[model samples]
Target: MDALKILIIPGSARDGSFNRRLAEFAARQARAAGQEATLLDLRALNLPLYDADLEALSGVPAGALRLQQAIQASDAVLLVTPEYNGFPTPLVINAFDWLSRIPATQEQPAGLAVTANKPAGLLSASPGAGGALRSMNFLRQYLQMAFAMVVVPQQFALGRAHEAFDATGALQDPRAVQSVETVLQSLARLAQALKTA
Candidate 1:
């Protein structure tokens, strides 16, 4: 099987965010599994808030365009989200809001180039017991609406995330580690299948 290209996107912009740590861990695991992984930090993208008026005036920002290109080039996407009040962080939502805009082209309608039929996986991390599961639900629905092929029904949520990792930033629990690896492996396998299909 050929190595799949996977994009890992962390939804949090805060330094030392648990979600970012989880994304990094997933990227490492994907590479270890012989897949090519790119970890994207949304904070570094510095995207402007999505506004139709602003877009009409200035067009999609360069940052957002770069993000769209990255998504288009990847075989699969893994969203590592952090929950805030039972929903995904505004950073994640805002990024997608910009990504969902239809481009001024006829070849592919609007966001189709970035989202349509693209394989995606959802995961979440939080300091609470729920592990951002509620947030993942909302994110999954949004991705489905955008026409992404969300292949994994068995989503991974890291509950009590603070205790799940160690000083070295590795997941401390064996079971948690196994779960993460399993999800990533599933994503790679599905991406490979789709690539050859």
Candidate 2:
């Protein structure tokens, strides 16, 4: 009877990224639904790009390991990404790569089992019209490789992200809010299904 733990991953490294704000909004919605939501800012993590040279010299960066630990602990993930060069930032992909390199662990006895039946909800945004759809497409595939149970039917690609939030960091779009709510609800149901099945 534990609360669901969801991690909000902001894809941008910008200090005031609108995508990050979107993640915040999603976290609030998930938390309001009786889940425990935490933010993991890519900018704040500041991890060195995944490097084979570094891995050979040092096992895994403490920061990287810390992120992996968090990934291990969480019950689900929410990715809020922005379209960059028609895709998400390299930082977000790097975060995934680093987490994947943790070696097949008991927490992950197998790739699928390692996640402990965690789920993921994807969201994307952009100032440009298409709304980061291409970037989200790539992220969706990446979730599969991580063995995450992705929530469908609520995929959100919020457009004109800058206009979607206020100075106080509140979400302004009712559609975007509703989309986030739907995704969170689906995530909850997916988690429940994974636990039982």
Candidate 3:
């Protein structure tokens, strides 16, 4: 089978975001597992808040268009988000909201071109004990119900994220490393199955 093309997106744009480190680690794991992985930082996208009127006047932002194209090219996606008051970061919500507003074209169905039937995996990191698990749960449900994404059951939430990684961005906890590998493997299998189906 052809290698699964995976996209790893981190919700936070901060220079020292633990979620970004987690995304980088996941990308490396995916590559070592013989899958092709790309890291997409939300900061670089620089998307504005979602506004219907603005969208109507100016059309979809270039960032949303780029995100859609990235999703269309990938076989699977891994979303690493930082929890904000038990919810996903504003960047994530805004980006998805913009993507969901896109009208359908003859080539693609209406709305959610970025997520429809896409195989997705969720991961979150936080300094608190929750490890952003609530955000992960919310994203899993939202992505599955709202966008019809095929979200893998295998997910990871790294609690105490500030101390979870080493100097090289590698997870210090052996268990965390194992958990990430499991999620990647599950996502790869799901993506491959969908590709051959």
Candidate 4:
């Protein structure tokens, strides 16, 4: 089988965001497990909030369209979010709201699926002990609505995520890496099952 492609969407915008670092770690794990992974940073997209006024005047932004395309092509989605005041950041929500709009399809666009019925996984990391776990519940439900089968067997909730990774994105704590690897492994299998079954 061709390597399962996993797209990591980072919810935090900070350049040094722990959430983003956790995403990086996940991408690495996917590769180490003989799968392909890419980190799609929302900060680079700099999407404006989805609004009727902007859409009416400017139409869908090219960047947003490109992002939707990326999501459509990927085999699976992994949302890595940071809990801000016990919720995900605006950028994360913005990504979801923007991608939620299904582009017009005569009978679904060719080989690619525009975020519908794709397998998804949720991960959250925070400086707090709870590890942004609460954020994952909301995000999982949201992704499910987008038609992504959320992988739930090995959910990751890393407390003190800042200390979980190093400057090189290496997971510093053995326990933390094991926790995340469990999810990565499960996702790898599900991606294959969903592709074949």
Best by TM-score: 3
Model 4 per-residue lDDT tens digits across residues 1-197: 68899988888868788888888888888899888898897867767888978877876666666678777777888888977777778888876676555366684452224666677787888989999988888777766665455555578888987677776888888888887888877777777887898
TM-score of each model, paired residue for residue: 0.93, 0.88, 0.96, 0.90
Give stretches of model 3 more than 4 Å off.
Answer: 106-111
- The global C-alpha lDDT for each of the candidates, from Candidate 1 onward, is 0.84, 0.76, 0.90, 0.77
| Among all candidates shown, the one with the greatest lDDT | 3
Per-residue error for 74 in candidate 3, Å, reads 0.3
Model 1 alpha-carbon miss at residue 19, Å: 0.4
- Candidate 1 has a TM-score of 0.93
lDDT of 4 at 114: 65
Residue-level lDDT tens digits of model 1 in 1-197: 66788999999868889999999888888898888999988777788888889999998776776678788889999999988889999998888888777585765446656777788888899998889999999888888876565657768999999888888788999988888988887877777878898
Compared to the true structure, candidate 4 yields what TM-score?
0.90
Q: Look at candidate 1 and give me any clashing residue pairs.
A: 102-110
Tens-digit lDDT track for model 3 on 83-121? 899999998988888778877887765558568899999
Q: Between 2 and 4, whose TM-score is larger?
A: 4
The deviation in Å at residue 32 for candidate 2 is 1.2
The residue pairs found clashing in candidate 4 are none
Query: What's the true lDDT of residue 2 in model 2?
Result: 82
